[model samples]
Target: MISEQFDLSNRLGRGDRTALGIWFWELDRVLLALILSLLAIGLLAVAAASPATARRLSSADVSLPELYFFYRQFAWAVIAFVTMLVISMFPKNMVRRMALIGFAAMVVAMLFTIILGSEINGAKRWINLGFMSFQASEFLKPFYAVAIAWVVSWKLKDKSLPVYPIIFAITGFLAMILMLQPDLGQTILLSGICFAVIMVSGVKFWKLAALFGMGIGGLVTAYFTYSVAATRIDAFLFGTDGITHDKLALSTLSAGGLFGVGPGLGERKYSLPEAHTDYIFSVIGEEFGLLACAAIIIIYFAIIIRVALRLFEEKDYFTILAVTGLVTQFCGQAMINIAVNLGMFPSKGMTLPFISYGGSSLWSISITSGLILALTRRNPFMHKQGQNRRYNR
Candidate 1:
């Protein structure tokens, strides 16, 4: 059986008749493993966080199970896994077309969200869809990245494509929509990803400088205009006793020391707002220990480094830009979420990818990961031929 497995893995030729066979030979299995590991860790972290969350929300009139959130997250994980696999199997052109359609559709959904979405925590970012609420911005992110990459890469082929202005217009339009939803976190994320994509497309220094200036100005405007943004910033800056989440998160990590309090033994999660979502890293620390937290960080870094290194050799301009945009957004969000947990950055309401407990977030990231895997796959036969020559057996 082991030999058969090896044969299937090592022999990438005309005899391989299965889709899974091709995928097994071509896919970045290490990256996939790392992603699955993070998801597994998320399940454990959410399981630890769920009991308290359930109890806190439960009332005499509305009793709930302790594992309520855990169960729901598990279901979402299953769905997300299937979604990622299916998407990763799609051809490159299909992925491109999918992104174009998804971007347009999500834009419409986001606009409708502004009109009819449910307000949650002062942001109209989610549309209530009977069974589950959807955050359109989450879905928009990867699609937007791909679409921008498509347009910018065209400019690479034909110099007169006016790519920079088109990039700016699309980004500006998205930023306007995000600010209307008052989703500053997603706004900043979307802008940063767009800038990175444009930068890689070899934009002029002045153009990059202008965008950076605009980003800074946007920050200042957000600080003054958005009460939530202002409150978070002020709390981070001047309010000694007001950095409640940060303080608690740091304290929680300290409590775990090296190993942890063990599984569901995390008491600090009870006091942590959005423990299973935004602050899930802190829960991992308190329950699973600093070692577990370090492992998660290592996995994230490995994935990012692996993708960035892979892109170094890629020759296609669109593949380079799109994958770079996707991976940058992936790592950037991870950094923001983890930084917020560690009190390094002001709270951004960003969920840790594959871990944070949001259905839309989980599914959206799955789509992003799927696209990355699809774009990054090498020709299996090419890879095999190279391997054979290197061995010289």
Candidate 2:
């Protein structure tokens, strides 16, 4: 029996006519390649930034290895890769079901986090899971996007469902919860995802304009009402009581003008905080240069464009909306991280997706990439048949 099982697995690996084989052939290979490329780049970036972070955290009594974070990040990347592949193999219905269920679970987890979570950086966002500290909000993002998309797409089936108000309530409630955690970055991101999905769902122009105006107003309110936001904004605008991370990041990022100073040779990264997480982009810029940073941005644009092209011919409203939400969340986070590193935006503790060194972030982003893969999976044979049937009709 063992030998037979091994043979069957080998056959599947060899691309035999099995479910795994079918998935291998049907899933979007180009997008998969792009995602893997980002993961690979992430490992390299982590390796480059690990020494600085490790040293910074080292104490007189306990010394950390230079590559400690890199090693752990590598392990997380491997696990996250496997998770992405497995989730990508799930069918569309399964994906939707998973997102809905996961969203509920994450909401519960967020509630628990609010009550019993450990505080980090003066925020109660992470809950201890014995072996690891899990940030519920980080994992909530992809699920929230899919859930919102699924709920909003109901209008296509029945226009009287009041989906808009339902989504608004959900978004508002979640925003309230996130603000209580004082995670302004996530609250802003969640709002952006909600707005983008509604806009893409063909909502009225007036509503979009109203939402945009409200978004601006919300920023103004945050600046006044949220101490963290107000401080960061004041620092960015007037350089009063500014954080050192942003200044160090800008200096490190510009140290390698066009071509990098070369990998592992950046001295400025030593003083840059969160070098392996929030400030990893600056490390990349210092070690790999401005050209490398531009390349990373270009790769992000490629992934977004690739997804957009894939959705061009999609007929399912839910798929279009879900994919749009996921992509917005993914790319939006990356844009924010890069913007912060470049001193164009206030520091928001956002991680560059698939590039930052953190277990929760890696897992969350991997699940996100997996959902995108699953939703966008195309069976050429079925697609052809559907077209033929439409022609016959």
lDDT of 1 by residue, 233-346 (tens): 988887645557877777877688888999888898888877778888988898888998999889999998888877776788999999988988888899999998888888
Encode model 2's per-residue lDDT on 202-299: one tens digit a residue: 99999999998988998998888999989888888888865766877999999988999999999999998799999999999999999999999999
Go through the candidates in order and give each one's C-alpha lDDT: 0.88, 0.93
lDDT of 2: 0.93
Number of clashes found in candidate 1: 0
Deviation of model 1 at 300, angstroms = 0.7
User: Judged by TM-score, which candidate is best?
Assistant: 2
- In the order shown, what is each candidate's alpha-carbon RMSD? 3.2, 3.0
| Candidate topping lDDT | 2
